[model samples]
Target: MLSSVAAPSALLPGASPVPVHEASAERDRQWWRSSVIYQIYPRSFRDLHGDGIGDLPGITAEIPALAELDIDAIWLSPFYKSPQKDAGYDVADYCSVDPIFGTLEDFDALVATAKKHGIRVIVDLVPNHCSDQHALFQAALAAPENSPARDMFIFRDGTGENGENPPNNWQSHFGGPAWTRITNPDGTPGQWYLHLFDSTQPDFNWDNPAVHQEFERILRFWLDRGVGGFRVDVAHALIKKSGLPDWGGRADGASIEGFPGHEAPMFGQAGIHDIYRSWRKILEDYDGDRVLCAEATIDPLDRLTDWVRSDEMHQAFNFAYLHHPWDAGDLRSTIEASLKAFDKVGAPTTWVLSNHDVVRHVSRFGLTGGHARSGDGLGPEDNQPDHVLGQARARAASLLMLGLPGGVYLYQGEELGLPDHTALDHGHRQDPTFHRTNGERLGRDGCRVPLPWTADAPSFGFSSTGKAWLPQPEEWRGLARNLQALEPASTLSLYRTALRLRRELSLGHGSLAWWPEYDAEGVVAFLNNGVLVVMNMGTSSVELPAGELLVSSAPEAGRDGFLAPDTAVWLRLA
Candidate 1:
């Protein structure tokens, strides 16, 4: 059961119940529409085996702590059997747990423990590709051209003299040609295979019925294990345009982002919807409000909304909103656009600030220039972030995001006010992007550093042996969970208070209305179920609305009936 926390009524002495609808059976079935799901990168979450690598048992042990946050669900990143080529994103076995993470029994314990605390488990499902070490991929390598095994993946004969060049111009996302030539039984260059990511992760030929059947079986296997749903990885890239067309005569190894349209040959294909519609049926068969959340990065809010249509996925990450600069106008416009777009498909918009694959929001907001792009790495050689300013903005952003009327996805360490290990040494990096780019791109290893639990313990209490896969920064000592647990003004305390009030007010399911009367030049003011939520982004303080102060991102900044810049507040209208 979730740990007891002070109720909003207790926090605000004269506050009345917010006029939001109560949860019922029907609402329960549609719980995901307004759910707060936390993404846990398993390898960095906790290490119970003293091996420096976190596992399932480590997560199970922290169930009580998670339950206290009042999150509706926990989304576990890929823990499937893999070669660790892409930090478990490259899966060799979807149905079993990786030996490093623990056994199947450990996973079962995690599911049961999470369920007992009213938290649902959402597994990461990688369907666009599989690890080269997968049984089917190995068989495909040995099988003759046009053989059934080879047909399971995209394979084609090279085009140039002596078949030395790749069949297409697609480039690997990690920084190289997307195709890798395979050797036949006689040691001849048999054919080339496609890998949108690392060469070790070969793209699956979704055109094959066998591929569809295999994933469907994999889905059922986990659904039977009591998982609430799956977070579909690269949800939009599963189906590529037929004929393997060239990307508009671009350079052979050019970046995919340089391509022209959202309907590029490699992504946002219409056929991908058909695939989700089938998975939706599988989820519908289950008793609970099972869901499919998409990790699609398609451009234009409308195109991304297509993944979350009523008959398809339940939610899709709003990447456009995530990448937007921290300006009131930009944020407001994005929020309005996202709400309108997802509303058209009868699906809820999902908001996110930081995730395992991107630079943490704290550092991004603190950058001297514009926000950092996805897959960007920060280090000692780069301009350092303003730690104090970054944390304040991050806290304000969280309050603003939680006040919106939709589902929210919180990254693992955001609540603890964690920042990326921007000064990590190059030699200590492990992301494939770092190696593939030949040290050009620093990659996402900085944000994936192990969590800090104890301020004084070695490895910050992440592992008993004091060993961590990715080194934790020394500055994290003050931000450790133990020290923050004792500080009432800490980010963790604010998160707990906000989460409790959000639940009490039913804010996630509430309606949103722009309170333009209170909006200033750089301030965003809105009313969520009669609660006035105000965020000041300008350089000076703004007069607060007539309301009883309930919670503020920077409480000290709310003095004199004025909200300071880089601060946010939730209030009950007087």
Candidate 2:
């Protein structure tokens, strides 16, 4: 429709120049193989221009911080154009940066700056759905009958007398029906489209080859813009049931807390494999070992292994261990399952005990004495411990994550000894999960609030603007990064030392075997290479049948492999 108009310079109208150097073949070759990715929720990071929201420049300015963390890369959450209905996950445009975050130029500068720091940028790609307001969706909505664009969405006919029944009884993850009826200009009604999430976010029909082409074009668009890789979101839900059957209504009569929402029979459909294969092709060409990490679920751990079969994804997160009890038997089976899954895919494994979504491990398992605290009915003993259990659980989880065969992914505050607690009043909750009005609860939000860089600064240096997007947890003050950096026995110090050791041994190079838990009550014990890993689930100290302590979650390390209350021990085997 228009001719190419050239700008005076490649730079934007007004911007400072950042050095750009093409990454060497070697640098990109094994880029994601052993890298540790730090996820950045743009809304919770620094607000550069003080618009009360974090932007590209703010992240660009913090590249030095990431470089110093001894991490593999930075995985940024959605920054694409969107209406912010479901945050940026409901992408409006794959190629453009949301104006709220910054301009296209800012994104380019951020990418260049990151590459210069020996870090690759892995973006959160949300292609399964798009904002209802997106241009493509709008075009499809306004199309003449039987148009190609119309096929992009799941359109259904109107029901007379009765209000239009949704294509099925499938529920949206955020709340109601997976389908929404559209009204025509005249008082008449038009067809409906399927949305797996918030209604404003409509699910794309993977059956449409055009949809595949559209996403492929989007992939190249960002790769050309210099993004190193992608962390595919809701990846397994790309395809849906053609029959569109009714969901056996909610169990508790609540839409959100029930299974019918996230794991609709439509999820992980067989047809979605072609979608991944096509994406893999574009990724192979542009990425020098660039990876596709599917946020595969932990509950039904086996469902997405096909995606990680090298043909689909480089790795998928095993969410099983993150929710495990501190028992030896549970840990053994969890590790066994992962070991088997890893061997099956012929791809490496990734481990973590905490992330933005789950309750922090130290607070949940280690501190609650193995039970996550009940948030609703609490009038009893506060029996809180004197010292933070996070210190011990942090070390324990780290020993498990880092000592595993694959790469270790530690969330931001985990290394800082941050404690987890639900300090939010009922009205202040912002998590997207909708729960049953009864005893049920939605996902945790306070765990992912913000990272504090300094102790003396206000809001722990998280902001200079209005209140933070999520309330900073009570554990924020003393655990600031700048403070812990100086303490020898601090969590930050331990993390740095462990990471250096991991890099030295090429921890990424070896495979792992989980030894039996060495206790009467199934306490987890694993043999990492030759090191003995024993975690004590009991309140008393447990002895280790091994060498000197390389690291101990408990203060009292005994020759008998004695671990303190809710603690873990790592020792070299003779």
Candidate 3:
């Protein structure tokens, strides 16, 4: 439960409050710098039409709920017209809405509704690839070899006996070979095309001027429709080395453990920055503080900062922070390094715990070991997580993340303490990764299950037809939002209180300073906006600093002036 404490005095002895700079019109326009953005997996957020799939109308209906959480924006995963080959990431038409989600009018309505609630919309933009069914790709298939149409994508002749093998040793991110052989319009085996992900999603030839012009037009179309910004998908892989060079890595395309730079021929090419510079010009030409957030997965986080340069991207997702273990020292080092790196480029660091491509943080923290690798879904065949321990740690982590001095991204249903459906039936899995790997890896279906809204309602009130695109676990009934809303100590309630106080105190815009006096093994303490935020990751309780208790992740956080293990508390020192 939220602790009841005395109001903070205007001033206190030996306390230095983090200064909140005066907000000018320019500062107000740059809201993304210190904003909290909510990511909505459109396929699972809500099924308003009872088709067992979430849609634009469902998101519009939930604007009030998002407003209550005090988030600044909503980042919708791909809803573009597609064949659903890659679950909407393989966009067929960048400007049209998919029938499975809704029509263009429905999307317009969502934008209008979000604007009315003072929330901006950020759409997912997949520029690296497109669905094979796209008109240009179809034209490329029908055109003769060496035709201008074929030049829009990477199509090269194979180099082997009878030209039967892949052009190079490059591998797909999903699984299997990256190149797929295609049949010529005549009855003969022809050149192969490159696809970094699934075969249905073919990579575009960024070297072509037409490809650049097409993406610019797509960007303006969405910006004209009043979107606040775009979350660039696979931002680092847009360009490849001039020669399709062979790689000496695993067939699965996993990065090496300690590689210092972009050794892979397919990713982090210097030419990618030129594309973004051109895009930045287009965004600056717009009216609002339109942003561009990169989803680049480059390693050695210092290299990742390149995407967030002032003239490139507004923010880049800090994967190092997301994948860090639950140890106090590890988290502290990651936070400090991320702050320092992004500070050099004058861009706010973006923090995230869970997303559509990874296991939920609650389940990840519940494991006995350190952080779980992305796409390593938990299941009945594997060791199960301790629900009680996972929930406690997740709550504590939330407080720590919220108190940091940068932007934050909240995955949908995380506020309700939802854990991944780890025990989902294998037969029901739909992720391409699972099929491509032949069930060797569990993929991300566990974290993409439909959210539970009502405890007893059919399909947890997600769909009127009592069906969901992905099945929800029966255990989720206990974590339903409707039931948790009435409980003061619930995770949902904790998030509400934390976000409210964060905005009231302008905590997001404030600075962070490590409080070294309370820093010990398995303990992390920091000061922000006159609040001493402390987390005890150790087994024993620690003495709390003298201050009024503002809020806590656990009910017994400040009991007897001691902060309990696995608990986080925010104390107002002034």
Candidate 4:
């Protein structure tokens, strides 16, 4: 599906579309209300210790670079102690930093340094489950059946003549059965425990009071360390339906809406809201408008809003907008629905284009031009990505995302316009997803490859000892941060400029109104804080709205009146 773009076919511009509204005064609220938070996948960011892995200290060393980008906060992926199973998603300890990542002292220093630079830190919280090596889980494993330690997790009796089968038909998010049979101390077949993800990560029984109390203590422990908020991992999967029902053989375990089993008993249960409500209270007790942002994939955009209610989470990642195809109509519909839904609960909408889990949008937008479908970890056997085309579209997509009202998150390497390492070798793969699916689904390691800092430096300067946990491709040398910083037109420069203007124009904290001037099949135009944003997603160049050009994602600003296809521009209206 990675093909060349079609020739442009110009179409006559029609009358005004939706009317623009005046800018609102909401920009003066808390920093989070309109903040732009950059997500840092700790493992792939940088490695200062030269141990071939990124650490908290390495991230602290990069704070000045992040500050220069004008971001208000940083959402760090899990850095807690873990067994490295599921790439740190399987946490062994919530209160301490992993030895590989750093110690608690290193974490304290990082937070202190980040605070000095006026950047807030939002930590990733894995409340749904913990690694089997965790103290609580270990105690549960050794304790007798029905002990309080075991009660904290979802351990249940198995079915079948010899009790060899799992408790239910639920599937793991990584692929395969969700339940793993455990053995008793007597060396006999025993009960099974649920793990929505990898087998090493056991799902906590949220129904248990001890589980709730433990999480509350975990929240306070981090809050005491000065974290501004949390990015809740698998926020929807924490609370499952009371009955562990059959999944009906559907494979899309992450999604709760589609497939034959629409109401999957594993995730997006109604009780999840109560958990957020309690966490929200903990955040309020601390200073600063500490927030909770959910990584929820609940469908029907409106229901997704429930996670961001007044008493629940402050923001929920808008995956609907992130997953929308590059078609203008689809994007416009998602934007409209997101605004309307979030507005109902007085919560700011959070927009994100890429994260550690999904295929990078740069490569994603390349295949099929606009309606592409590329899975993560695509190797040599898969269709190659059009990096040039992908980079161009990715730049435009950034401007469009930043210009909208509310918060936005920029993934680690997106500023460098890094496309997924589509040809990663199978032996280097680490995501449990790849193993669980037996290489049938290549996991998310391609996007998680370590960042490139210096073009010619060993390991792209990601590690001083000349090795990276994941190999960096030679093609990435040209896209390194140092090289991009010198090029004014580079994707990094575009993001720096866009983020600066997003604040100067008060776009993030303002209201959005559909531009009434132009409405074409594959074009979307919106006005926020007197700035008119126009994007041409169609095969043809569209007329740019009249205004002084502030910034254009295209190499050159539209001459005469037309914007090139796949380009986006911000116009400062008179």
TM-score of each: 0.94, 0.85, 0.95, 0.94
| Model 3 segments more than 4 A misplaced | 1-29, 250-261, 369-375
Question: After best superposition, candidate 1 residue 115: deviation in angstroms?
Answer: 0.8
Model 1 C-alpha lDDT versus the unseen true structure: 0.85
On residues 463-567, what C-alpha lDDT tens digit does candidate 3 reach at each position?
888889889999999998899999988999999999988888777776777776555648888888777788888889877656778889987677457778888
Candidate 2 vs. true structure, TM-score: 0.85
lDDT for each residue of candidate 2 in 66-91, tens digit (9 for 90 to 100): 77667887888898998886668888
Best candidate, lDDT: 3
lDDT of 4: 0.84
Q: 438-519, model 1: which lDDT tens digit per residue?
A: 8777888999999999999989999989989999999999999989888888999989888888888878877777766444
Error of 2 at 127 (Å): 1.4
| Residue 566 accuracy (lDDT) in model 2 | 64
**Candidate 1: residue pairs that collide:** none
Which stretch of 10 consecutive residues in model 2 shows the poorest summed lDDT?
1-10
lDDT for residue 296 in candidate 1, whole number 0-100: 84
lDDT of each candidate versus the true structure? 0.85, 0.67, 0.86, 0.84
Deviating ranges (above 4 Å) for candidate 2? 1-33, 158-160, 249-264, 298-300, 366-387, 434-444, 516-521, 554-561
lDDT against true structure, model 2: 0.67
- What lDDT is reached at residue 229 by model 3? 97
